[model samples]
Target: MKKLLLFVCTLCWLLPPAQAQTGTYKGIGTIVFEAGAPLSLIKGTSESANGLINLETGKFSFDVPITSFQFLNSLMQERFNDKYMKSSRYHKATFVGRIIDKGPVSAKGEAKVTAAGILTIHGVARKRTIEGTLVQKGNNWQLITAFPVELSDHHIQAPRLSSGYGASTMNVSLRMPLSPTDPDPQQIVAVKKFGFR
Candidate 1:
């Protein structure tokens, strides 16, 4: 009986904590943005946004290829990539951060959450606090967030009248459906390098 009890205690001590047993989720999602112009809103979207979230630690990372964004007007898309965003020089925009709120998310309904992270755009990184909602359905989770980006903050020049483009700010929205899975090794390394662990 003494030996059995000792074995059980040892086994329990070797096991990981419940909080450390949470799964990581990774998936590709849709990202959309809108900018105000003189006559109409410039709307664009991309289905190539990739994201990873570790529920146990609340660490998350998201990235989207700048050239993947599509616009209603091909010329506008070209201008956005070449002249405005300079996608050739800065191929992608990324965000890495962790959730700051406490309490476990209830599976029954939407839960409001806030995340503070670094948002990198146009080769510049800025710290931002974003608020969003999380909803659980079956074995997957859905996260949605909307935030505004100022042109000046990232050193992106405002559109010029002669260029027939004018947008001072861009409203960005992200909708991601994340499912539990083993994360890519490279992605894990990148996330750790960003200090999210």
Candidate 2:
């Protein structure tokens, strides 16, 4: 009985049971930065969307959560919700694109790819290019994107710098964990027709 109990305890310690990642998942991400400074201006991720990651073909389809934009502080959040972003009308900012560089992520340590496509924000679709880097350890993948998107590109009127802030492109950061999902664009968002714009 003591031996059995010891074995059970050892198993529990060895494996972090619930912390393991899942297949066919929904990930939440944040975009934190100012147009020219570091501020949590935009934050959003999909609670429900297709996440079929084709490491082989360097293709992907995803939906950016429409209702997840929160401001840096409570004050900013209120201001953004009420005035700047007007989250109620212009819900989500979505993107649909494919990785340009294809490689066998069959086994990986560090891999980099460039994803260029369209970003629709506040009812406007504009061209954008962002670099994606992934660090894979076992079945888990850590992804990161370092890129800049100009607010003017999407026609986000910058508040006067004298009273507001000085910035043109809003710096963006995206991190997500890949999961097992269907490889179909039917439920997947269309780069040309996604309604998140």
- For candidate 2, the lDDT comes to 0.56
Model 2 TM-score relative to the real fold? 0.64
- lDDT by residue for model 2 (1-197), tens: 99999998777557542222122233445555455433423432333432444554445665555456554357655665556656688876777777776333434466766787777877789877777776665545556676777777877765434336545666676777764344242333322121101
Which lDDT values do the candidates have, in the order given? Answer: 0.79, 0.56
lDDT of 1 by residue, 23-132 (tens): 57788999999877546777889999999887667889999999999999898899889988999999999999998873345556566778999999999999999998
Residue range with the least summed lDDT across 10 consecutive positions in model 1 = 188-197
Off by over 4 Å in 2: 1-26, 37-52, 102-108, 160-165, 182-197
- Record all residue pairs in model 2 with backbone atoms less than 3 Å apart, i.e. clashing: 66-92
lDDT, residue 66, candidate 1: 98
Q: Cα deviation of 21 in candidate 2 (Å)?
A: 15
TM-score of each: 0.77, 0.64
lDDT of 1: 0.79
